[model samples]
Target chain A: MKVRVEVMLKDGVLDPQGEAVRHALGTMGFAGVESVRQGKLIEMDVAEGTTDAEVKAMCERLLANTVIESYRIEM
Target chain B: MKVRVEVMLKDGVLDPQGEAVRHALGTMGFAGVESVRQGKLIEMDVAEGTTDAEVKAMCERLLANTVIESYRIEM
Candidate 1:
């Protein structure tokens, strides 16, 4: 089985790294760039018997900073 | 209408940052750890009338490295 997990900052959280990327892009002549926030994508090929519950556990325990981020998993 | 876009390397693409993050987690005594691939989460709060076509265009023009990545947009 395969699972994809995404972890991102909660709304209102400050994202300095995303801001830096936005600044860099603006300097490159891109327009209407809007806003950018950055997070992480984690993909793994698991045994065919993988369960969503187990994967969610992986997220709560190790994949994200719950104080500042929320995570979702798809299998 | 706000939008969130995620950009990720195609499968088989290397993710040094994710590997580094994984290594750090391992040292922290996290177990049942698996592989991790890193990508980006980009979020924005647009005007009430933002269009998906425009967002897709933005992804094509600037948000993602089409050569090595793919993107998805959510409203």
Candidate 2:
């Protein structure tokens, strides 16, 4: 099975990387870019019988930093 | 308007970061993780009137390295 994990910074967390991108876009003359937030997308190929709980454990254990990021899993 | 851009390495390109993650997962005792690929998700808040062409231009010129990465845009 294929599992996709989308990990994003929790709201209110400072995202220096996203801010940098937004600034770069402004300087590149792409006006009207009000804000930007950057996140990660991890695609995984697992054994057919891999359970959702196992995948969730993967995120909790490594894929995401739960203190500052939230992740969603899609199968 | 909100725009989402997903940028991923082109197939056949080396992804050392993904490999490292996979290795880490293996060592952490998460078996059945056959393969992993990591990508970026960029979310932007743009002016309401921003057109798709402009957004595509952003991806082509700044968001993704066309030589090694492909990007998908969502609204």
Chain B TM-score of model 2, please?
0.98
CAPRI band for model 2? high
Compose the digit string of candidate 2's lDDT tens values, residues A37-72: 999999999989999999999999999999999999
Candidate 1 chain B lowest-lDDT run of ten: B24-33
lDDT of 1 by residue, A1-69 (tens): 567888888889998987876676567654455677788878765556766776776678778889999
Error of 2 at A57 (Å): 0.4
B6-59 per-residue lDDT for model 1 (tens digits): 888887888887787667656765444476677887876555666787677768
Candidate No. with top TM-score:
2
CA RMSD (A), model 2? 0.6
lDDT of 2 by residue, B24-48 (tens): 9999998989889999999999999
